[model samples]
Target: MNKIKVMQVVTTDKLSGAEKVVLDIENNLDKDRFEALALCAGGELKDLYEKSGIKTYVADLSSLKPGEIKKFRSYLKENPVDILHGHDVKASIGAYIASKGLGIPVISHLHSSYPWLQGASPLKYIDRFYRKKYKLSIACSHMVKEHYLNYNKAVSEDNMKVLNNSFNFNELKEKVILPKKEMRSRLNIKENAFVFGFLGRLLDIKGADLLIDTFNKISKDIPESLLVIVGDGPEREKLESMVKNYGLDHKVLFEGYQKDVYSYLNLFDCFILPSKLEGLPMAVLEAMAMRVPVISTPVAGVKTLIKDGFNGIILKERDEANLYEAMIKVHSSEDNRVALAENAYKYLVENYNIDIYMGKLQKIYEGIR
Candidate 1:
């Protein structure tokens, strides 16, 4: 029997939640039974994918342009894949169009519940049309599955399934081995500082600004505190300006888009994600796998991942006051921090391990094939 050939199509080159999912599938797919490849808009991820020995193709799949679709269609004609697994809307749309009459199954993997999919947006109807064309739609969380079912009545339940984001604990364990003191020194962080870290795209939806506001309120309370932000995006300059305005220029460090975030996760005293929206965040899982305590606003899938005061802190409200209290609570006790990390790590081991995810994903791919 021939190995299943899968091509994961992504719109962006940056490393974020959805992009990381594509990488995970590419790296961990069963080599004996499957052959994984990537088609990306071309950026940092392209290099990373190639370096990992996966064949990666560069193309702007973020648009519905005729040339872009033709490029994808042409590529499929020359070197066909069993599955064209497209991540998110644009890439899925491109794949849906390009794979016409090619007999290859296009899998739409949704990573978030976008606002455009609600209310009376034209995009929602357009999305509804293309969604039904796919062999299957994989929602990153149950929240995303419900969101689509609620608004897009045309989509059948039989055609969709929920698969949460997962992490490879084996790979994670290796990366977290770097000495904490060495990592802190490289980033100019004090050994004893209470580091509150955020790692993701610096976008408004991610609420990096809200995190800054919450940190600004409590920075004075915790004098030896540092807010280290890893990852970069359109909001970088805006967020940096906000930090400067709060006089947190010295206290805040923006370690723009890191290829190796596990090293940073290993050093963080606590990981904070103040996102206003999310499907299921990969950063939180990475943090949990690193055995780092987490504090996050109750976004889409966060409520499922964290239990307030249990495995991690879940903010009741997305405001400076609540976040400030949560930060202070964690800062006040070392025992609380250790307990949170332990529970989080255990929860990750039982629930979101890569084997569970890969098993389900491969089943979906084979079912479609």
Candidate 2:
């Protein structure tokens, strides 16, 4: 039997959610039935993919010169891949144009509700034309799907499918021992600290600044408190400024993009996500799997994964008072935190297991026939 050949394309260099999802699929899929190839914009992920024994391609996916398009066309002609998957706006355009005459079906996936109107983005009708050309559409969240289907007049709701991002949940039994004190010692986080960890690509919509404001409001009373943010993005410098302005330098730690995030996840007592909107964030899911309680804004896909005050705390919105109140409630009671953690672990094991996700994803790919 011939293996299914999947070539994936993405435009960013960061370890954003979409890149991670693509890598996870490549890492977990059945080797006998599938061979995944990756094409990404220049970044650390590109190097990692290439080093992992996968045939990886790197190109300027932002603006394709005719020469670049011709080169891509040559590669596709030679490879004759079974499926072409595009990960973001620029890559989606590159892919649609590259697959023009190959008769190869294209699958374009949207992991976030991209601000398509900003930054010289083509109008919704124009993107709808691209959508119509693709064989399949994957929206990373149900909300992301609705955003496209409802706003884009030309988008056929039936053309899109909603699939939450999947992760490598191969539960590590002999866990890497990251003592809270040792992790704190390295970061100067106090031993008895109440740390509210926020991990994700730092964006305005991610509500990092709101977290900073909330931390400021309560840090004096909760003297043994610390806020650690893990991940980097366009908003880092601005976030750093806010941390400085708020005098949270002593209590807030900005640890940038970590490759070993699971290890980092172990150091937290609870995870806080204050996104204005979210698909199911893998960061929250990781915290859940690692047995850390989560507090997040009530958003579309998040409400699906977290039952309020059960496995996690759902805030009314990104307001500082609401986030502060939720964290204070969790921090005030160890019993509540422990109960939420246990429930989160159980939820992750039952719903987000690696085998279960691969079974579903493989079924989707096989449906192409």
Task: Report lDDT per candidate.
Answer: 0.89, 0.80
The 10-residue segment of model 2 with minimum total lDDT is 117-126
lDDT of 2 by residue, 194-288 (tens): 88898999888887888888889879778888888999989999999998998878888889998878777888988998887677788888888
Structural similarity to truth (TM-score) of each candidate: 0.96, 0.93
Give the local distance difference test score of model 2. Answer: 0.80
Query: Using TM-score as the measure, which candidate wins?
Result: 1
The sequence of per-residue lDDT tens digits that candidate 1 reaches over residues 1-369 is: 899999999988777788888888888899999998989988778988898788998889775789978988999999989999999988998988999999988999889878777788877888888988999998989888887788889999999989999988757655636678889989888777989999999888899998898889888999999999998899999999999999999999999988788889888999999988888999999999888999999888888888889999999898888999999999999999999999999999999999999999998888889
- After best superposition, candidate 2 residue 226: deviation in angstroms? 0.5
